[model samples]
Target: MFRTQQSRSGNDLRFSLLILPGLRRAGMVVRLLMCSVLLLALTALSGKFGEAQAAGSTAGKHRAASSGAKGRHRSVRKKAALPAKARTPARGRRHGRAAAVVAGATAATAAAAVAASPAAPAKAITTNTKPELLPRCGFTEASRRHIFSRGVYVLDEETNTPLFERNADTVAPIASVTKLMTAIVWLDQKSLPMANRLEVTEDDLDNLKFTHSRLNVGASLSRADMLHIALMSSENRAAAAMSRDYPGGRPAFIAAMNARAQALGMPHTHFENATGLSPENVSTPRELAELVKAANRYQLIRNDSLDKQKIINIGRGQLQYINSNRLIRYGQVNATVQKTGFINESGHNMVLRLLVHDRRPVIVTMLGSGTADGSRLDGVRIAKWLNCSLN
Candidate 1:
């Protein structure tokens, strides 16, 4: 048995040796196939890991998403919780926005109230009162400048405190500012409420040529309207009616005007007509300043002096009339109150009360100048220039 087993083993060895070369070739081919399969599997695994790392980094690489499967699970839950408001349709979005705005406003208001508790300072109140007087003007013998001024005077409503008295006290015809007195007298004693109707006839429009009036016949006006036109537009008809409708007639109104002048200590002043159309009507610039002060006391005239425009209802419709004083046009003080008058007798006359810088109030009256408008424009220009220079 031993000998037979040995013989078979030997034959098997001899058989194995004969096929060894072929078997080794087959083994080399198998080893190559196994290595190719391992390389392909490794490449696939590397691609998967690279893609997972890229996706994780894109999600902000936040600590909440970077801790393995637990972080990814939390990220998914958070994404499901809320989204942008725009994800919903725009229908009724305005209402939702309004509600959110109201909520935000409520929160802001609560915060503001808490911040502004009880210790805040109050705001200031202001009024259009007189500004401080500027430096005293020296147009005296010592100073040769300001030749056109002739002299300087601190002309006031109370008295002409003669700072430089040339012919300043000389009484002369003061023009349209005379209407201011006319309005004042009418307001004092008339048909109670002077805002009455006026029967404007052709007779009333007779000699108001150099002057202008848009008022027509059968035009109804409140006494307020008449006064407004009289002081603001310098309307002749309004002045005539105010004068004629006095206790008596034109005479009474004129008497009242003179009486008021006397009451105001205007000894050199006299008014013949409600309007200063007649060269016969005269007053000193000094006295007229005082007259203005008195007339302005009634508030109605002062209110009229500042009016920019007025629309009076005629029988047909409304007629627009603008104030003649250029200063208070549209409430800008080119001229706070100004009266312009020119009659053939009185060359051209003006009384202008203007606002100046530093809240100063200035009064200028011109009796006669060469131009038709009676240029106290020089005086106004001087005042404004001085204000600009000083301010």
Candidate 2:
């Protein structure tokens, strides 16, 4: 019985030893798994933090660029608002170039960031309040070299060759130069006798520009006298009266003016009214040169336009109308055909057909002079140039 009890105790002791080693090994495996899970959690949190930091940095850069562009735009506006006397041109130009460069860089970076995001609204950047100023007239730098007038053209009447040209193709208001055409159209109708007396009425008053005329309403004059005054003095009333006296009235006269212009190869020329009070009466310098050539064919236009003064009897009084062209009255040029015109839109305009050397006929037309004297000076300069060329 004692031997049997000792064997059972030994068997229990061996089983206990084996179970303890297996329990220790299982604990070590469980601890290793827990450590690995903790490490994975820490690594995941660090990666998420890095991503958030990068997104925040990108957003901050975008905001900074947007604000910078806005600041530049405000600065440019302030500079433009400065008084002309206060601003130095050299400094202004430098700042302008710098602003342009900064603006371009900001726009490119912002565009790149926007393309990456695609959900953000794009901000507009403005650089200046007023755009850059550009030249209004003259085709080439050489053509605009010395000419102050907006448009200038010199043509040799004999050969119809353009001697000099500046903004010659630009169509603009011609003012009372339309009268030359009016005289031509009026005389074209041989049936309409010049001896027939035409009375100035309220309809003849310039309603478009409210211009003054010495030929008062209700004054009576022959058709020939109306043409004479219109061509010589740029009398708006006389031209309007003649247009009203046409077979089909003012509308027909206007149509005839346009038709005559078309026939004369003046495709860009248009006439809204005979008196040239309307700004719609437009012609190019080249086209007007052709017009001068055509009007020179009329002997009466040549006779009346060159006259310095005309004393006409009107209602028991004689009103002597002086020629409007200072170039003619002052003997500045021996103009065969000369007409001067002015309006707010057309400026001081003049067309002249004059003998330059001995008998070399040349036509000079200038438009957009600031003053009457300016127009006269332009004509004088052109005449001198022509004389030099002829010699």
> How good is model 2 by TM-score?
0.63
Candidate 1 per-residue C-alpha lDDT over 176-247 given as tens digits, one digit per residue, 9 for 90 to 100 = 768878877777774557545666666566374456667776776777777787787788887877777667
Q: Candidate 2: list runs displaced more than 4 Å.
A: 1-146
Alpha-carbon TM-score of each model against the true structure: 0.56, 0.63
TM value for model 1: 0.56
Global Cα lDDT for candidate 2: 0.82
Query: What residue pairs clash in candidate 2, if any at all?
Result: none
Candidate 1 accuracy as lDDT: 0.64
> What are the Cα lDDT values of the candidates?
0.64, 0.82
Number of clashing pairs per prediction, in order? 7, 0
